[model samples]
Target: MPASIHAAASGSPTRADGRASFQKARRRASVQALLLALPLIVFLLSTFIAPIALLLARSVENKEVPASMPALSRALDAWDGRGVPDEYIFALLATGLRDAQQSGQLGTVARRLNFAQPEFRSLLMRTARSVRDETPPAWKPALIELDERWNAPETWRLLKRAAASPTPDYLLAAVDAQVTPQGNVAFVADNASIYRQAFLRTIAISASVTLLCLVLGYPVAWLLANLPATSSNRLMLFVIVPFWTSLLVRTTAWYVLLQPGGVINGVLMGLGLASHPLPLIFNRTGVLIGMTHVLLPYMILAIFSVMKGVSPVYVRAAQSLGAHPFTAFVRIYIPQTLPGVGAGCFLVFVLALGYYITPALLGGAGDEMISQLIALQTNTQLNWGLAGALSAYLVIFTAIFYFLFNRIVGIDRLRFG
Candidate 1:
């Protein structure tokens, strides 16, 4: 009592000073922890984040045409797109083309433009070749005389648009949309569209694979959970052994089985189930089978893990309470299995979205997915812009799907059963 009264009289707060010291200590510890992690953070940024960021930025940055024809790109900036360009615009183009042609880069400009409007490459190549030796007195008339396409205001407008830096043309084209001559977004004609169809096929195939994994894996998971440990372990070895095998090897095995003269067909034919071998490989059926087989283990494992934890007592109690066996199983057991179901579906769907080798090796021309299309652009056509755009689109789709799935199923609670 005397110490309390004396402390109150002195009015020196002990807790405040201790708190200040504690906070200072905490700050020092935090700094030390950050310093320890700094190298890992820098490494990730340099190796992973930096490259991904650069690729994503390339999807929207367009410099090919503008870089080749700087003078024309600058001059056309002022020319109204309403009618045929003024002499100044033509003069700029004539000189720019001559300079670019001499530098052997005019073809590059033309190639970039041709992606926006067909036949532009030939138009530009012919014009540049004809005028390479002559300095025309009147550039506008010379250009128009060389090619009637030069007279169209739409052509000039398109040229101007194409040379504008950081264009949307490539990004738009990735999704089957185009920047029209009138400066508007329009979908490419149905026949010319490839991205939209590829995206649809990817989604359809992924959804089908997810559904197949769920339908096929759930029963196996339940059986494993109910079986003796020894038997369950042996069965699980079968499920997991596929993972130990090479993906290429597994796909090839499926190919052999699904092929016309392959094992499955041979058996069916010998059993008189069909008159001839079925058309399975090199089609959607082959794509589905390969994807499902590769991904089914993940579903089984996820469900089996969760089911292992669920108590049989709950089902017994519900049955003892006068519920039928099916009702008890459905009401008491299934509700507890939801987390496993969500986890399995989420994993299977996400994996299926990125599947490449199986589809490429097993499926036919029409079964090509977005990843293959991106690869075709990146490798075959060497169109990095389109490839980057498609990648960005896929990333966006995956992120959106993830967000929606998380919202609906509470991914945080989706324990890996």
Candidate 2:
């Protein structure tokens, strides 16, 4: 065979070994990459995905008592509305309470029922006490006398209603409901429909703040984006200076500045600007001022970041083409900055929707956001189910906003800008 042909057919032994070794190294690198991603995958699954899933579950978790006490649910399933419940129904309640106590979820079961009928907690406690204190033979009669109508089919019906689970029953009530037995629908009582209103009000206030930020930040960002690097750096220090202080400090500073006797009023008085102190703090005006100050930087940063990428040549070119300054900016310059506008709007809007501290400090009764109500439910009422449900709804609202924002303006546009 020719030397070249022989070399091609046999290959070099060292070259073959080198190729095999390279394949092994590549396989090892692939395994290393997979290993490195494993922790992050696990962390996201556990901390982010898992908790959100559980929270969503809690928002609709209604079946615990009924599932545990199937026999009671079945026994009560047939009865008419006239008579007292029988021994089987008592057995179901006893079983449900025992299982609830065992699972350490009696509290959860109790609270759901509490929303339907506030006396449910006391009923659960009494039933638990009755089960512990009285002998088995006396259980039915004693419980009947404790509430003689307890034997009535309506009483058992209420228990079954509380026992229904994995349903939107909680969501129904979260929005305010008088849920009916025959249908899944609820009638929203005119007086009790606060949640829907609160949700709307929250969205409105958030949008207002976002608009204020846009109106106020646009000029500032435009100026900053046009300045010399040193001037821009010095100007940004004013924005960043607030970050160095605690959020509470910034909020409190607004309180002092806006208060009747504070610096702002003093200055106005000195300047003969007003005869009386302005009602600035502890109201809607105060909330607007404080939130606009707090969230303005986000707007500025978003706008400035996008503005930096926009070439001045575009405006110059437009002018060179016989466009006036305003026309060039509006027709050419402004379109280029829409991505930034969308980003800053999304950021400020989302932040403002969940705003708790600034609103709580500055807003009066009418201006309280949903976050404040969630806090009240969790802390004051100790109603975790309601709080959890509210949180779930808030997350849903935020997700809806994010989805719409992404649809209206792609996330890529925001990120690249």
Best by TM-score: 1
Q: Clash pairs of candidate 1? A: 305-417, 306-417
Writing each residue's lDDT as its tens digit, candidate 2 over 1-417 gives 976667778875566778999999999999999999999999999999998777667777766566656666566556553456667667667776776677787787677667777787788877876665555765577777776656666556677666555566667767776556554577686666788778888999899999999999999999999999999999999977877888999898888899899999999989999999998887888999999999999999998999999999989998999999999999888778888888899999999988999999988888888999888987887666677788888988999998887776675455434
After superposing candidate 2 on the true structure, give the runs of residues whose Cα lies further than 4 Å from its correct spot: 1-52, 63-85, 94-111, 124-142, 151-154, 411-417
Give the Å error, residue 57, model 2. Answer: 2.7
Model 2 lDDT, residue 252, Cα: 86
Q: How many residue pairs clash in each candidate?
A: 2, 5
Q: By TM-score, how accurate is candidate 2?
A: 0.83
Q: Candidate 2: lDDT over CA atoms?
A: 0.80
Consecutive 10-residue window with the lowest summed lDDT within model 1? 408-417
Q: Deviation in angstroms for 337 in model 2?
A: 0.6
What are the RMSD figures for all models against the true structure? 3.3, 4.4
Query: Positional deviation of 290 in candidate 1, in angstroms?
Result: 0.4
